[model samples]
Target: VKQIGNTHNREMLPSCWDLTEAVIRHLLNMTDKEFFYWGEYLNEKAKQRQTQYKGPHQVFQENV
Candidate 1:
């Protein structure tokens, strides 16, 4: 569990297994709405990256 600046070093994962497991676990733990909601969150985050956000930003909702 490597943490720097409140972020975990995802690159430290030996392979994609941990990531896949985490996604599967998240899907299994969340409801259908939650799954789609999470997907929207990811989409918004991606957009934020494209927009060149330059501060401590949080993606809390889906982009419209």
Candidate 2:
């Protein structure tokens, strides 16, 4: 049970990481087109993460 919980947590990490990367790029003045592309990628990752996600972050839920 502990291992399964750990694995689920690991699976959810990528979406958060992608979101952080995108936000950092935005702060760095990344182009809108480039940011959109990254957003799309993050959206995909968010969907995948949704399968095992249990967090209450509204951004993920809204985007997903």
Candidate 3:
């Protein structure tokens, strides 16, 4: 998780790590096929968002 944050050049909050760890623990209980499909789904979503992604600050300003 730390490596992922570092790779993205983002500073992850402790709560983010906790949430990720919780999700990982839940994923671990899934069957191998289920886990593989989940990984593919997440990767696809990430790719789809890669081009027009907005940071948190931008989102907040737009909302405000």
1 against 3, candidate with superior lDDT: 3
Clashing pairs in 3: none
By lDDT, the candidates rank as 2, 3, 1
How do the predictions measure up, each by TM-score?
0.46, 0.37, 0.44
State each model's CA lDDT, in order.
0.72, 0.77, 0.77
TM-score of 3: 0.44
Clashing pairs in 1: none
Residue 8, model 2: lDDT of 71
lDDT of 3 by residue, 1-64 (tens): 3454354444444568788999989988999999899989998887667546777865675679
What tens-digit string does per-residue lDDT give for candidate 2 at 1-64?
A: 3444466776767787789999787667977787888889999997788766766775666788
Alpha-carbon deviation at 51 in model 2, angstroms: 2.2
Best by TM-score: 1
Report the poorest 10 consecutive residues by lDDT, candidate 2.
1-10
Clashing pairs in 2: none
